[model samples]
Target: MKKAVTILFVLVFMCGGFMQAQVVKSISLNSGMVWSTQKFDYKDINYDLPNEYLTGFHIGFAVEFLQHEYFSILTEIGYTQKGFKLEVDITTPDFPEGGLGTMEIKYSYKYAYLSPMFKVRKEFRGFIPYVFIGPRLDYLLEYPTDEFSEESAKYFNDFIFGMTYGLGLEYMFGSFGVGLIFQNQYDFTLAYHHELEEGYDSGVDIKNNAFILDLGVKFYFGKE
Candidate 1:
């Protein structure tokens, strides 16, 4: 949408100013474990199946804006997977000639995600502890492979906005840094909507959430 592009452009312009004015830079390679699920909200319909967490992996690269051991801006970009597993119970007298059957289905979606965060840290004897909070933007990579068709994919969103918050610890080995971080990610949009032929949606329908633990290797310059 035009409005979304405008907002993104403004944020990029502001970040460029900050980068030019202040002077510290670090680049990192990161990957982690993700436990994700879809939560549903509805006014009239309810999902009867039991949903559980789906496990996936996240790998990314991050750039830092400052060298001050106290505060900085971190911008990260990564490819990740998020989804839920559903358990459904049904009587199978006709389909399989059995009395009961339970079917387990998992829905996995791939995304390109970006996070630009404010990082604050304290350093003591080559060890650093930090916390970060940021806004996350996710772009859908493709329709899920299971139970999703091209027609059904139109109801899904291509881009969604969310929040990512976490805490991490790092150790400095001269010019190199290694860290492990714990993060919580939550999206604020519907996975599916039925009003394409009608009008705008009123409220949330289904949202995605995840818990992540990441490990990273960092290279820094302009540090004290």
Candidate 2:
């Protein structure tokens, strides 16, 4: 985590050093689709583990704090519906029946991210090359599925915090612009729980992380 922050700071310093050209203050809107590479683990009362992934769309805004032909710092926010399904093999201590079933867990994640990104735009062309790294905060809004019980719902709250980083490309034509961004986030908090009285133990040596690959378009409000 500390390393990521340090890298972002370094990028900001570099952008500031080359900020003698014209700068613009504007905000842009972004909307695109996301594909989840891995399935989110969902646990049931019997401690069955199901694997799943999500495919959905996202819409967000990017507010430029400092923008020049070479670099920019932007704050972005978006709402996404990421859903995945987990399949657990039922041959364990609780279920000796040896059956196979699947459960779908859906999450509505609202995200707010602040990034100090650097871009290298052409002097006469509209092509822009950019890279971004920053911190991201996610709030899980809805987690409802028929496969999960009421007690399990409490374990899957709608709040998450993580770090985000990515690289992208953008093209501007006057005031109208389009961008493609591919970002991924690492979730530090494992938002998983069991029905045990002591609650779900944290040290299970399992994987608790989330990420997304985004391809979107952005409209810069000012002259591109």
Best candidate (score: lDDT): 1
> Model 2 Cα displacement at 79 (Å)?
0.6
- Model 2 poorest ten-residue lDDT run: 201-210
Q: How do the residues 56-164 of candidate 2 rate in per-residue lDDT, one tens digit apiece? A: 6676656565556566666666666555545444466777776656344454333333433433344437777777776666665445455557756666644566666
194 Cα displacement, candidate 1 (Å): 2.5
Q: Give the CA lDDT, 0 to 100, for residue 131 in model 1.
A: 96
Per-residue CA lDDT of model 1 for 1-224, tens digit only, reads 45444655665676567657665477788899999998866544454436899999898777788667599988877778899898776655475654476777788888777899999999889999999999998887755755867755677888889999999999998889999999998887765665423343332356789888999999877555
TM-score of each: 0.80, 0.62
Candidate 1 TM-score, true structure as reference: 0.80
Once superposed on the true structure, which residue ranges of model 2 sit more than 4 Å away at CA? 1-24, 37-50, 87-124, 194-211, 221-224
Residue 123 shift from truth in candidate 1, angstroms:
0.7
Query: What's the CA error at residue 178 for candidate 1, in Å?
Result: 1.2
